[model samples]
Target: MAEKAESLDLIWEVTEIARLIGRTERQTFHMLQSGQLPAKKVGGRWVAERGTLIRFFMETAA
Candidate 1:
């Protein structure tokens, strides 16, 4: 039997969030550190819930 790949319910790294927001990884990290973006540390990695990112865009777009 073959193992199935895990399905991710959220983004758990700055690089992934950067790609989603069209920003550089370094920029994402800066935002995270400055509290300009929403994220939480899980298992030693920073993660952002998908809904949170979408809400951020909606709020900022308004």
Candidate 2:
């Protein structure tokens, strides 16, 4: 089962995000590099805020 929002980590790695979005890791990385996805590099790994990603897609969705 998934953790509750209050217990969930605010940050998500590229692989996790990829799974969430139903895309492969490579595709997710490409989107991140091309500015299509919002993320930041920390300690050599790509990460994004759960809330930020949710809002981004919600606001920009067609």
lDDT of 1 at 17: 88
Note the residue pairs that clash in candidate 1: none
Model 2 lDDT-worst window of ten: 1-10
Candidate 1 to truth, TM = 0.78
Weakest ten-residue segment in model 1 by summed lDDT: 1-10
Best by TM-score: 1
lDDT of 1 by residue, 1-62 (tens): 22322443588799998988789999999998898888887787889877788789789999
Number of colliding residue pairs in each model = 0, 0
lDDT of each: 0.83, 0.80
Regions of model 2 farther than 4 Å from truth? 1-8
Tell me the lDDT of candidate 1: 0.83
User: CA shift at 29, candidate 1, in angstroms?
Assistant: 0.3
Candidate 2 per-residue lDDT, tens place, 1-62, comes to 45575664556678898886678989998998898988888888888877788888889885
